[model samples]
Target: MKNFKTLLFITLMGSLCLTAQNNDTKRADKEFARFEYVDAAESYLKLVENGKGSDYVYGRLAESYYNIFNTVEAERWYAKALETSNDPEMIYKYSEMLKANGKYKESNEQMEKFASMRPSDNRATAYRKNPDYLPKILEQGKKFNVQNAGFNSEQSDFGGTLHDGKLYITSGRNDSRKTYGWNEEPFLDIYTLTENSDGGYDNPTLVNSYINTRFHEGLVSFAPDGNTMFFSRESYFEKDFEQDSLSRTRYGQLYLFKATKLKDDWDEVESLSINSENYSVKNPSVSSDGSTLYFASNMPGGYGQYDIYKATINDDGTIGEPQNLGQKVNTEGQEMFPFISSNNTLYFSSNGHLGLGGMDVFYTKEIDGKMAPIRNVGIPISSNADDFAFIIDEVSGEGFVSSNRDGGMGSDDIYTIKKLQPLCDVLIAATVLDDKTREPISGANVSLYDDQGNKVVTKSTNADGIAEFIIECEKDTELEVTMDDYESRKVALQGTSDEESPVQISLSPIEKIITPEEIVLNPIFFEYDKSNITAQAAFELDKLVQVMNKYPELVIKATSHTDYIGSDSYNQRLSQRRAKSTEQYVISKGIDESRISSEGKGESEPKIDCGTNCTDEERQMNRRSEFLIVSGGPESQE
Candidate 1:
C-alpha cells in the first residue's frame, strides 16, 4: 500500500510539471507571434532551464535574440538549434548571426551547407557566386566617409533625413511614453536638429507635438515644396488594431500619414489611401519632382515579406494604386526604407539581395522608366548588423544612414555620410538621331571602343534615343552607332570638364528598293580591282542580315557582277570569290548557310550595261552583289 501511494504521487507530479511546461510554451509562442520578443525570450529561457530544450524551442529562442539584435545570445542559441535542426532558413540566419559575432569562417561553412540544401534560393545563389565577397567588398575601398551624427541618445535613434537646413530623425528617447515589447524602448517620435550658424546641427526638438504620439511615429519625408509631409506612424493613433484569436493581443500596423504645413506647424494630419489594416505601409519618400511617391510595405500580393512600392501622386494630392518594384528591386526577404535622390537613384535597404549581411543599403537608378540593376552601396554603409534608412544628395555628395553596427551609442544610431568619390568615373550620355529627319532614333546600337579599337561596351538606345556609358575618364575612346537599316556612324569620344554635353550621332537610312523579285540595297563598293569586303560593303550587308533574321524562312541567292575592265576569266574568278565572301559573311552574322546560295555572273548582269566605255560612277554601280529572294519573299512577314 505504501509503494502504490509513492508511485501515484510521482506520476501526479510528473503530470503537473508537463502541464506547466506546456503552458509556458504556449505563452512564449504567442508572445513571439505578436513580436513581443523580449518577453518571449524570457519565457523560452525558463523552458531551457527546466531541461525542456528542443529544436523548435532553440530556433525560436535564437530568432528572438536576432530580432532584438543581440548577436551573442542569438549565436549561442543558433548553434544549439543547428545541432538537430536542418532548416535552411534557420541555418542562413545562424550564418548571419555568426557573421555579426565576427565568426566569418564558421558562417561561411554554414552558408555552404545552406547553398547545397536550397540552391535555388537567391541568398544561396548569391553565396555560391561570391563565397569570398567580404574581402573584395573591403578592398573596393570606402565610398563614404562616415561620422557619428552627435545627436544620439541612450536609446534607439535612427532614420535621419536632411531637408531645408534641418536634420529630421526618429528617436525612442521619450522615457515617459510606454515601452515597446520588441526592444523595451520608449515609443518612437519624430525629432529634428536645426542647423546652427556654425554649419553644425543644434540639439534635437520634436517636430510637432501632435505628430509625436504615444505609439510609434517617425521616418518623415517632405514634399518638394516643403509644404506637405509624409511619415509613418502606428495605426494605434487612430485606435486601429487587430485581435489575434483567443489571446486577443492587439496588433497595430505601421501606416503612412500625410500632413500639411500650417505656417509654423504641420496640420491636417490624415492617413494616406495606401494604408491598410491588413499590412504595413511606411518609409515614405517623395520623388524629386513630387510626381511619384516611393514607400515600403508588406501588403498582400507582394513578392516578399516587405517590398518597395511606388504610386503616382496625382495632382489632386491623392495617391494612385501602389505598384510593387518587382523582383529586380525586391526579393523574398524584407526590403524597406526607400529614399529617392535628385538624380533618380533609388536607395533602399534589404537583406534579400546580395550583401554583407543584415539590411544593407542598395541603390538603383531609373533608366527610361525602368529600375536599373541593383548595386550594393558598399562597406561603411553596410555591416553584419541591421544597417538601413539611407538618404543622400547627389549634388552635395553628403547623406545620412542608420545602423546598429558595433561601437554605436545606442541600439540604432544615425551617421553622417560624405561621398569620397565622384559619381561614375566618367559619364557619357549619347543620343542617336536620323540624319535626314533629325529626329531622335530609338533601338540604335551604340558601342564604345578604346584607343586600340577594342570594343568596350555596347548599349541599345532607349525610347528617349539615349545610350549612356560610364567609362574611364583619361582613356581616348570612340563611339560607334549602328541600326538595322541605317548607315553606321563613328565619332571620337571627347573629354569634357564639369559641364556635361550629350554626344549626338546621326545615321542615314540605308537606301534600298524592295521589289517582289529581289531586294536592291545601296551599291556595295569595294576597293578598285579587289574582291575583299570593305567597311562600306559590310555596312550595306548588315541590312541584308537584318532582313534575313526578321524573316527566318526567307532564302536569298547572292550573284556578284563586275565591270568589263578585266579579262573574262579574271573577272569571273573575282566575281566568284566576291559572291562566296558575301554568302560567308551573312552566315557569320547568324544566318543559316542552307538559306543562301552564291554564283558569279561576271559582267553579264551589269546594271549600267556601258561595257568597256563605262565611266567610274557607272562602273562602280555595275560592280555589286544582288540579293534575289527565290523562295521566301518580303510579303510573308513584313
Candidate 2:
C-alpha cells in the first residue's frame, strides 16, 4: 500500500508540470496577438532558457526580436530556428529581416532558397525582384522606438494632448456600456495621465463621462487658461435616442467640450454648440490668443475632398462662418490633424501633395493675415506611411506621432521624436561699389562667379548705396560687377575670415563725353510740314556723334517727345521712329550699337504745365528731343 501511494503522488506532479508549460505557451500566444512583442519576447525567452519548447519557440523568438528591431539578436535566433526547422514562414521572415538590416546579399540568397521551396508564392517573387525591399526613407532613420502606454489592451489610447505637465489620451478600453458599434478598431474614450518628477507618465485615469462616453471620442484641444476644451466625438446607431437625431447630426460630429477646474480636478463638463450639419469637422486648432479656430472639414465649395477652414470666435462663445483658406492652404486631397504652435505657425498633415507614400506633415506660417508658402518637414518626421497626429511638449521640445511603416509593432504605433539643434557656422558678407565717386548706384548688377566662371548668385544692391550679401564660402570666390555704362569689374578674395570682414570693392568709372558741356539742341518747329532733320538739329546731332565716338564706354538714352496734335498713337509711333533714326545715325558713324538706348516719351514730361489745351511754347517743349547723362565719366556721376 505504501508503494502504490508514492506512485500516485508522482503521477499527479508530472501532470501539473505539463499543464503549467502549456499555460505559459498560451500566454505568449495571447500577448503576440495583441501586438505586445516586448512582453511576448520576454515570455519566449523564459521558455528558451527553461529548454522546454519545440522548434517553433526559436522561430517565434526571432520574429519578436525582428518586430522590436533588434537585428543582431534576430539574426542569431533566425539561424538557430533554421537549424531546428525549415519552415517557409520562418525563412521568409528571416530574409525580410536580413534585408531590412542591409544584408542584401545574404537576403537574396535566402530569398532564392525560399523561392525554390515555394515556387507559387508571389511574395517570394517580389523578394526575388527586389531583395532590398525596404524604402530608402526608412533607412534614413524614419523608424523609432515606441513605448506602449501601460493601459488596458482593450482601450484605444490615441489622440494624445499634452498641456501643463499632463497628457490626455482617448481610450475606450474601460467603457463597459456597449451603446455603439466600434468605428475605430476598438473604439476610444478620453483619459488623462499626469507626469511624474522622473519624466515618466503615471497610469492613465478616465476623465468624467461628460467628456468620455460609450460612443467614440478623441482629439482634445485646450484653451490657454485650461478652462475650455475642444474634442471630437461620434454617435452611432446603438445609442438610445428619442428621434435618432444623433444619427443624423452627431454621427462623426466633432463637438467642443468644456470643463472647469474644481479644486484639483476638472469638473462641469458641457457640450459647446459651434457646429453645423453641412459638414463633419475634426482636428480643432486654436490660435495662440484663442480668438481664432482652425479645423479640418469636408464642406461645400472647397479645393479638395477635405480642407482646412478657419472661424472667428464671437464674444458670446458662438462661432462665425467658416471660411475656406483658399487654394493656397487647401489642396485637392485630404488635409487633417492641424496643430497650431505658440508662434502662430500652422502644422498639419496632407495626402494631396508629393510625399513618400501616405500622409505627410507640412507647415506654413501666418504672416500678416496671409499664409506663407507651405514646406514639408522632410524625412525622419515623415515616412512612407500614414504619419499624422503629432504634439510637441512646449518645454522639452520632445514630441510624438503615429506611423504604421515597415518597422513598427503592428498596423500602427506611436513614435517619439526629438528635435536636433543644427550646427552653427561663421557669417560672411560681400559688397560691390563704383570706384570713382563712392556713391552707391542703384540697379548695378553683381554676380558671384565660381573658379570655372559659372555664376552662383545674381543680385542687386538695396537703396542704402550698399549691395551687401552673405555667403558661406570656405575658399575664395570670384565676383563680377557690371552696369549699363560702367566697365565690368572682376575681383577675387582669399583667406577672408569672420562675419563682419569687409569686402569693399571699387569699380573705376568708364570715361564718356555726355557731360554738361556737350552739344545741345531744343525742339525745332517744322511749320506744319516737315519730315527731315533741321540744320540746327543736324549740327547738334553731329556733335553728339562726335561725343559717342570719343568715348566707347558711354551709353546715351536718347528720348523723343511729340506734341498732342496728331492722333496720340500715330504721334507716339512717329516719335519712336525718329528716336531710332537718331540711334541708327550714331551706329552708322562707327559708334557701338550696344552703347545707346532710345525711347519715345510721346507728349509726356512737358517743361511747362498745361491743361488738355496748351500754348505753342508748351507744345514745343513737349515735342523736343532730350538726352540725360544716364552713366559715364566725372560730371555724369555728379
Candidate 3:
C-alpha cells in the first residue's frame, strides 16, 4: 500500500540469505541480500542460463522481484519454483501477485494450496471467510467525507502530520531535486504550514535546510518539548547503503532521524541508532508522552517486508532496541505510516492485512495490554490505490489521508477528511380494501412481519383504509390485513433504498354458495383451442372448489361448448377434451370425481344463435363453460 520512496520492504524470509558454492550463484545471492532486486534478477537469470538453477535460487529470485513490487517477474519465477518446491509461503506470495495482476481465479487456486499446507494462517482464514473480498470493498460506503487541503502543492504531496496546530507534509514540489525514477517526479521534501483563523492554511514553507536532503524525506511527529521531532529520511544523506557487485550500483535504504526544532526551523538532525545499511527503518510515529516511538521497518527477524515496530525513547534522545510489533499487526505485505493517537489507539496503513483495496488505514486499540484486531477505516479514507499517512484531531473528528488516487494534482495528495453521520431507516405502509366491491375497508387489523416471521408493527386501518409503519430496511416484509368475516390477505414489501410504497390488500368475502341455476361470474378465457386450464380459469375453479368443500354432499356437472369453425367431429372432440380437462382440474383440487361429471356441447347448444352469419363476439359467446350443482343447490343449502 505504501509506495514510492515512503514504502519499505525485505525478503520473504531472513533465512533466504542463501550462500551458494559457486561464485556466479553467490553473486546473485549477494545482490538479493543487498536488496538490489533489478540487478539480482539479472544475476539469477545468468545462473539459470548457465545451468546452475535450483528451487532455492528460483524462490529467492522470485522473492527478490516481489520485494521490488515487480509482480510480473515475481509470478514467473514463482511458477518456475513450483516445479521443484511446495513451500506454503511461496503459494501465498504467488497468490498475491496473481491477484495483483487480476488473475483472481488462479490466485484462488494458489490460496487453496497455501490453506491446505498452513490452514491456521490468518491470511488463509480471511480468504476462507471471503474468497471474493473485492466486491465487499467496492460496495462499502465512504468512511469519511474528503476535500482538498488549502496548502496542497502542484506536485506529489502527502503525509499530513498535525503537530502544535501546524501541519507538516511531504512533497515533490521542489524542482531543484533530482527526478526520482519511481514516478519520474522530484524527490520528496518536508514542508510545513500553519492553520489560518478561517480554517484555511497558510502557504507552505520548506523545513529548515539541515533536516532535508537531496534524496527523500517523509512526514514527522513532534515530542512534548516541540523541539524534538522524528521522521523518515533516505540513507543517502550519510552514504549509508549497499553495493551490487555485479552492476557496481549502490542503493540507499530508508532510515529514521531525530531532529531538534530551532527558532523558526528544525536542526540538530541525527539518524537513529536502529538505522541499518542492510534494511530500511522508516515512517516514524510518537506517543503523546514522547517516551515511545512506533515505526515501520524491513529489518531482519520481522514478520514481513515492513512490520510496525516500537522503541522506547529515553530522555537522552537515544532509542531502545526496536521490537517487532508482532504478527497481529504485521503480514507478508507492506504495513507502514503508523500514528499513535492521544488516547493510545494505534492507527496505521497496510496492504499486508485484509482491507479495501491497495493500502487501507487501520486502527487497533490495546485491550488488556494487547492490540485488538486491526479494523479498516474503509473507503473515502481508503481505496484501490495508495492510501496512507492518516492522522486526526480526535476532538474535531477531522483528519487527513494521503493518496495517489484519481483527481490528484500530482502522484500523491493530502485530503481533508471529516466523519459524517449514517443514513435513516425506510418507511413501510399499506392500504386495505374489500375484494368484491373494490371499496376501502376501515378498522381492519394490519400486521407487518419480517422475512423471519418476527412481528414488527401492528395497527388498524384508518377511515381511508390506510395503515402506515416506519421500519428498518430488511430482505422482505409481509403486510397482512384481516377483518371479521373476510379472508385475510398479505402482500410482500421490499426495496433497495429508503423508499416507501403502500401495499394494496384485498380480502374476499367467504361466501359458500352462488346462483345454482346459472352462476353468473367473470369469464375464464383459454388460449386458442387449447385444453390446458389457465391461471384465470384455475382462480374461477377455486371458488367452485371452496363451495364444494363447504358443502360435502354437493354434485356438479360441467358442460363445455365451442364455435362452428371446424368440422363437426373435430369440434366435438375439442369440446370433449376441454370438458375432460376442466373435470380433471377440479378433481385435482380435492373435489370427489364421482360427485362431478362433464359433457361436450360442441356447436349444437350455442349461447348466441345466429346460424353461420355470426359475428366474432357472437362466436366468442357461443364458446363457454358452465358449472351447475345438481344435488346440494343454493336452495337446498339455504
Candidate 4:
C-alpha cells in the first residue's frame, strides 16, 4: 500500500508539472504573437530551463531576441533553433544576427546555406549573384558626417523627422510611463527638440499629450504648410485589435493617424482609412507638396514583412489606394521608413539589398518618370547594427539618422547628419603594358592631372603593372604614363569609376624606323587625286619634324609619287602639290623651312614597276613619300 501511494503521488506531480509547462508555453507564444518580445523571451527561457525546449520554442526565442535587436541572444538561440529548423528565413535571420555580432565568415556560411534552400528568394538570388559584396560596400566613399545628437536618452530613441526648425522623434525615455514588453523601456511617445541659436537642439519635450497615448506613438510627418501632421500609433488607442478567442489575447498593430494644429497644441486626431486591424501601417511620410503619402505596411500581397507603399493625397483630403513601389524598390526583405525629400528622392531602410550588415539605408530617385534602381547610402549612415529612419533636408544639407550601432548611448540613437559631399571619390587604376609584346610594364611613371592641368599625384607601376589614384569623380582628368626607352603617352580618363577593369595603356618604344640616310616613317595617306593634308599625313610628318628638331642642322627632302591611273604630266603636278603640302606641315610644327626640301618623282620612281598589269596592292605601294636626311647624321652627305 505505501509503494502504491508513492507511485500515485509521483505520477500526479509529474502530470501537474507538465500541465504547468504547457500553460507557460502557451503564454509565451501569446506574448510573442502580440509583439511583446521582452516578455516572450523571458517566458521561453523559463520553458527551456524546465526541459521543454523544442524547435518551436527555440525559434520563438531567437525571433524575440532578433526583434529587440539583441544580437548576442538572438545568435545563440538561432544556433539552437537551426539544429532542427530547416526554414530558410530562420537561416537568413541567423546570418543577419551573425553579421551583427561581427562573425562575418559564419554569417556567410549561413547565407550560403540559406541561398541553397531558397534559391528563388530575392535575398538569396542577390547573394548568389555577388557572394563577395562586403569589400565593395566597405570600400565605398563616405557621404555624410554623423554625430551623436545630445538629446538621446538611455533607452531606445529613433525615427527622427525635421519640420519647420523643430526636430521630432520617437523615444522610449519616459520614466513615468508604463514600460513596454518589447524592450524594458517605457512606451514610445513623440518628442520634440527645439533648435537653439547655435544651430543645436535643446532638451526634448513631449510634442503633445493629446497626440500621444499610453501605447506607442511616433514616426511623424508634417504637411508643407505645417498645419497638419500624420504619425503612427498603436491601434489600441482606437480600441481596434484582433482577439484570439481561446486565449483572449488582443493583438494590436501600429496604425497611421493625422492631427491638426489647434492653437498651441495639436488636436483633431483621427486614424487614416488605410489602417486595418489585420495588418500594420506605420512610419508615415508626406511628400513636400502634400500630394502623396508614403508609409510602410504589411498589408496583403506585400513583397516582404513590411513594404513601403505610397498613396495619392486627393485634394478633398482623402487618400487613394496604396500602390506597391514595385520590385526595384521593394525586395523580399523588410523595407520600411520611407522618407520622400523635396527633390522627390525616396530614402528608406532595408535588409534585402546588399549592404554592410543589418538594415542599411537606401535611396532611389525618379528618372524620366520611372524609379531608378535603389542604391545603398553607405557607411557612417549605416553600420553592422540596425540603422533606419533616415531623413534629410535637401536645401540645408542637414538631417537626422537613427542607428543602433556601437558607441551610441542607447539601443537606437538618433544622430545628426550633414552631407559632407556627394559620393564622388573615384579610384582610377591603370595597367601599363608594352605595345610590342603586350606584356606588363613595371617601373613606369603614371601621373594624374586635373582638368585645369594641375598635377594631382604620381605613382609607379608595380611588378604587375598597376598604378592607382583616388580622384574627385565627375570632373575631367588626364593620365600620363612615361618610362625609360618608351614613348610617353597621355590619355584622357574616359568613363566613370563604375568600370572595374583597370585601364590598360600600351606604350610604344622610342626607337623609330630610322636609318643612316633617312628617317623612315609610316605611309602618309592623302585624298584621291588631292594634295590636302589628311590627319594621317600630319601624324607621319610629325615624326619627321621631331627628328629634325633633335638635330638642328638636319635637312630632309620629301619626295612624292602617284599611281599609273593618271597621265605622267598630271601625275607630276599632283605629286608636286603633295610634296609641298608635307613640307608646309613640318614648317607649321616650328621646323625651319629652309632645312626641308621637296621633289616630285611622278610615276618614274615606281618601286614595284608593275606598269599596266599593276594590282591594287602594287599601285598602293607605288603611291608613297620619302624623308631623306640630307645633312646632320654621322653618315650624312651634303
Q: In each prediction, how many residue pairs overlap at the backbone (N, C-alpha, C within less than 3 A)? A: 0, 4, 0, 0
Comparison by TM-score, 2 against 4, better one:
4
Question: What's the TM-score of each model vs. the native?
Answer: 0.60, 0.47, 0.47, 0.50
- The digit string of per-residue lDDT tens for model 3 on 1-638 reads 55633433433232343434245477777765544455677788887888878777788778766654456788999999998678898889898778756677788999988987888999899778766656555454464698877567678898877777778888999988889778888999998888888887777888877987788998788887788889888998988887899998779999899888778667889989998888998888889888999999889998878899999998888899998888889988988999897767788999987776689887776543456556667677778888998988666768888888888877788899886632113445577889888898999999876654545556898898887765544357777666655655567776434435567888777452366564444565677866656544655666666667766777888888888889889888888767766776676566777878888889889898888999999998988888876787656876
Candidate no. 4 TM-score: 0.50
Residue 80 miss distance in model 3 (angstroms): 32
lDDT of 4 by residue, 1-638 (tens): 99999999988987876676567689998876655556688889998998888777898889877654566898999999899668888999899778756677798899999999899999899878767767656656477899998788899999777766778889999999988777789999999888898878878889777888899997999988898899999999899988999999879999999999888678999889998989999999999999999999999998988899999989877889999898888889999999999978799999998887899998876643456556777888879888999999888888899999999999999999998776444557789999989999999999877764545567799899998765545667888887766656678875464413258899886555468877778787887876756544654565666566666788889999888988999999888877876765676567776898888889989979998999999999999998887877634423
**Lowest-scoring 10 consecutive residues by lDDT in candidate 3?**
6-15
RMSD (Å) per prediction: 22.3, 32.2, 24.7, 28.3
Once fitted onto the true fold, the runs of candidate 2 whose alpha carbons sit more than 4 angstroms away are 1-155, 175-184, 235-252, 267-274, 314-316, 406-411, 422-638
Candidate 3 lDDT: 0.77
lDDT of 1: 0.82
CA error at residue 505 for candidate 4, angstroms: 27
Question: How much lDDT does each candidate structure score?
Answer: 0.82, 0.64, 0.77, 0.82
In model 2, residue pairs whose N, Cα or C atoms come closer than 3 Å (at least 3 residues apart or on different chains), thus clashing, are 155-173, 171-189, 172-189, 435-507
